[model samples]
Target chain A: GDSVTQTEGLVTLTEGLPVMLNCTYQTIYSNPFLFWYVQHLNESPRLLLKSFTDNKRTEHQGFHATLHKSSSSFHLQKSSAQLSDSALYYCAPSMNYGSSGNKLIFGIGTLLSVKP
Target chain B: GGIITQTPKFLIGQEGQKLTLKCQQNFNHDTMYWYRQDSGKGLRLIYYSITENDLQKGDLSEGYDASREKKSSFSLTVTSAQKNEMAVFLCASSRTGGAREQYFGPGTRLTVL
Candidate 1:
C-alpha cells in the first residue's frame, strides 16, 4: 500500500517571508507522480503543482515543488508568503495512470497560516 | 473547465441509519472517485470508477458501497452510520491517464448523531 507523509502539521509565516512545507512518500512503484493540492476555506481542493520526473521542478501560482526520487521528497516552496496563501496543503502520491493501478493516497496535510 | 456538484452539502443522520451521498461531474472524464476526509487525516479513497457502470473498491470501502450509474453520476451509500461520526466526503473526476490532475467537488459534510 502506498502512503504519503507530511511532516509539518502547521506552518506559520509572516507576509513577505518565505514558505516551505515538507512532504515525503512511500510507494512500491517507480516513477510515481507527486502532487500538491491547496484547499481554501469553503472551497474544493485544487491542484497546485505535480511532477513525475525526478529532480524536475513544477511550479504553479507562485508555488513550486520538485520530486526528488532519491530522497522521496516533494517539498513545496514559495518565494514569499501572501495572506491568500493561508490554507490546507496536501501531498499525494499516485500510481501511474492506466497501469492496472488505481489508488491515490494523500498525506495528513499541512495547514499554512500566513500572517501580516 | 467543468464543475463537480455534490448534493445535500450537509447531512445529519442517526446511528444505524443508512445514508447515501450523490456526486455529479460534467468534466467528461473517464474516471470518478470518492474519498473520505477526516480531521487531521488526509483523504482516503473509498471507491472509483473508470467508466460508466464500473466500480472499484478503495482502502476505506468496508462500510460503504458505490454505484456508477452513468458517466456523469457516482453515488456512495453508507451501510450504517456510526455514532458521533463526522467527516467530509469528496467527489473527484479525472481523465484516464497516469498522474493527471483531479478536479474535486466542494465536499459533503456528514454528521452522525
Candidate 2:
C-alpha cells in the first residue's frame, strides 16, 4: 500500500529559526505526486506545495519542498520560521487507482509551533 | 475561484444514532472525497466519488455511507455514532484527482454524546 510518513508529531521552534519537517513516502508506483498541506488554527487545510518530478524543489508562501525519488522523501523546509508558520502540516501523495479515481494519502500530521 | 461549503459546522449526536454531513463545491470538480481527521491521526479517507453516481470505498469506509448525487455535491452518513467520539470531517474536491491540488471545505466537527 502507498503511505506517507512524518516522523515528528510536533516541532517547536523560535521565531527566525530554521525549519525542517521530515516527510518520507512508500509507494510501488514509479512516479509519485507529493504534496504538503497546511492547516492553521480553525482553518481548513490548504496546499502549500507539491511536486512529481524527482529532485525538483517546489515552493510557495515562503515554504519549499523537494521531492527526491531515489530517497522517497519530500521534506518541507524554510530558512526562517515565523510566528505565522505555526500550523499542522500534512504530507500527502496522490495515488491513482485505475478507474476508481485518484486519491491523496495523507501522513500523520506534524504540528509546528513557533514562539516569539 | 470557487468555494467548498460544508453544512452544520458543528454537530452533536447521541451514541448509536445516525448522522449525515453535507458538502457542496462550486468548483464543479469531477471528483469529491470525504475524510475523517482525528488528533494526531491525520486525515483518513472515508469515501470518494469519481463522478456523479460513482462511489468508491476508501481505507476507513466501514462505518460510513457516501452519496454523490450530483457532481458538485457529496454527502457522508455515519451509520452509528459511538459514545465519546469526537473528530472533524473534511470534504475536498480536485479537478480530477490525479496530479491535482485538492480544495477543502471548512469541515464539520462531530461530537457523540
TM-score of each: 0.93, 0.97
lDDT of 1 by residue, B1-113 (tens): 89999988999999999999999999898889999998887788899998898888887999999999999999999999999999999999988775667899989999999
Error of 2 at B68 (Å): 0.6
Off by over 4 Å in 1: A97-101
Q: After superposition, how far is residue A69 of candidate 1 from its true place, in Å?
A: 1.9
Clash pairs, candidate 1, are: A97-B97, A97-B98
- Considering chain A alone, what is the TM-score of candidate 2? 0.97
Minimum summed lDDT over a 10-residue window in model 1 chain B is located at B94-103
Residue B22 in model 2: shift from native, Å? 0.4
> Candidate 2, residues A3-75: lDDT per residue as tens digits?
8889578899999999999999999988878999999988889999989899888889899999999999999
DockQ of the candidate models in sequence: 0.69, 0.84
